[model samples]
Target: MRVSSSIDSIYQNNVTLAQDLKSFVDTHIISNKYEKWHYISRIKSLESFALKLERGGISSSSTSLDDFFACTIVVENSTQIDKAKDLVNKFCDIKCKRPNSNNFTHKQSSSFEFDDLRLYVTIKDDVTVPNEQIKKIVFEIQIKTFLFHAWTIAVHDLTYKSDEINWGKQRVAYQIRAVLEQAECAIADILNLSKLPQLDKNNKETKALNKILNVFKNHFNKIDLPSDLVRLCSNTSLLLNQFEVKENQLDAFLKAETSAGRGTKMLGLSPYQIVLLGIFYQCEDKLLSVLMGEIKLSIKIVITRELLDFIQPDIRKFILDNSIPGIIVLA
Candidate 1:
């Protein structure tokens, strides 16, 4: 589809601005010790903010620039946001001075354009690095959660149809947009949960899930993780059953079979893999239901059982420290 020129500029600006901000933040603060990608590469969650509205340009009827939204990044912790604003102003003002060296005696100033919209990056405190490193290293960054990472996704290609010509309900489109907004809001909330300084202050499930996903994303391609993972889950399953949790045994049975037998081996699930598997599956489920706080102890029970069948001796060792013998599994 032909995009509007104004909207096109906005789209271009959004990507450029985000990268520039990331670059500016990294160079000024992160120090030479850290690679630039290390800070931003881990941002798998940033792509969530992109909005995929059709007619991605201004028409005669269009009124505001928001019509072509690329995405939103929110910082839940107010201190971090304020610091970022300060840094932007500080850096830009200095840049605007051209050849002039503004010093302690004279503070520089410049006209910077950006509306600070508060979202969630989940940082606990508004602490900055040493005065010298303030420019490169930012405490945290929060981005809107979108369905997919790239230019489009199933939600957009299927939902927004201009060429094929399909219309079910006008409200469905609005509902999709609403859900997208909520996803962005929840991402802020999750970021807050991620950066909690004290364990007692943060959302346990969100933190736990994020960590597991990190492990999976980092290692899944390199090695297999289901066999031992299944074995570990066995212990958790038995423990959950002891607590009288009624779980879906069928799911448990399926996972147990899948991981323990030739299927997982054929797929090349590696050694000591239960913890990662259990954590990934459980966390994915939890994150999927972040809007709902209730944990699914029952499904966890099944997944745990599934893990048990695949446990290798080395993999079995991992559960000794993490397992709760009598508590119900929170899958």
Candidate 2:
């Protein structure tokens, strides 16, 4: 009866953790704006827990099971895996992390394990919660790419976990997995296609936009950027022929600025704003000239508003106080 009561309590705790995990994920991961992703969660059923206990080969204690509650975060591609890992690290206390074979070299064409990244974490003390349930329990977070996740959902259980596990069915499952693996490889290598250069050869604007997006992707570790903002920035960059702002240069500038004690002042700016600021610093004279002379009044106003939105509050105050001559005359 005591063991049964303990199991019941554990099940309730797992349920609470699952709920809190969703809230935590919604707060951190959902807000990041990945291109494609979804999450699924489940608390182990009471019967499953009992079966594990009766099996008696592993730790029978409920508290010892890391996967009492589990959540799977499936992303469109492997690139977002790092971003997910970063968020997990920031928000939770990682007890153990199992790195998956993302760069797997499959020697056997017929075998596929489709191992995915798994993290066992307890909620960090810094993250606020309604109850202490999260801190007490360790839960699992599995990160899987879309292709692999699809196979697992559609075919894995029917073949691998089926009551009648025939060799033929298992072989078919492996064959399907191999195909999915090839598809993932092709998707990863699509950027390196030989014809892509020829196709985009004349599209300098597209190239500029891509570069800007890449910058955002690397710095923010996000799969997608705001298209309108990116397009606007890309156009401005192309206008001045100054889209060649290297990432290292931007990083150095930010480091120097932060060191000089403007970190607090710059705290209000978003990631997009920071990138724009770096661009502004790189081509200030050209940008100022283009804004002041050539651009239309409406364009000038829009550009000015975006730049002003990006700049530090104190800098905006400075511009206001000085009247900044042509800077905000139309704005």
User: Judged by TM-score, which candidate is best?
Assistant: 2
Model 2, runs deviating above 4 Å: 1-28, 31-35, 56-62, 100-110, 195-331
Q: How does residue 244 of candidate 1 score in lDDT?
A: 40
Whole-model Cα lDDT per candidate?
0.37, 0.62
Tens digits of per-residue lDDT for model 2 on 1-331?
2347766665665566556755665566566636578877776777666556566622544345676667888888776778878877877888887753445554455457656788888878887777665566677889889888888888877885577959887788778888887888777677776357565364666666666555445544332345566664554454334444553354455555456544224555555555446555555655555445553322222224545765556655665565433344223
Residue 264 C-alpha lDDT in model 2 = 20
Q: What clash pairs does model 2 have?
A: none
TM-score of 1: 0.22
Global local distance difference test of model 1: 0.37
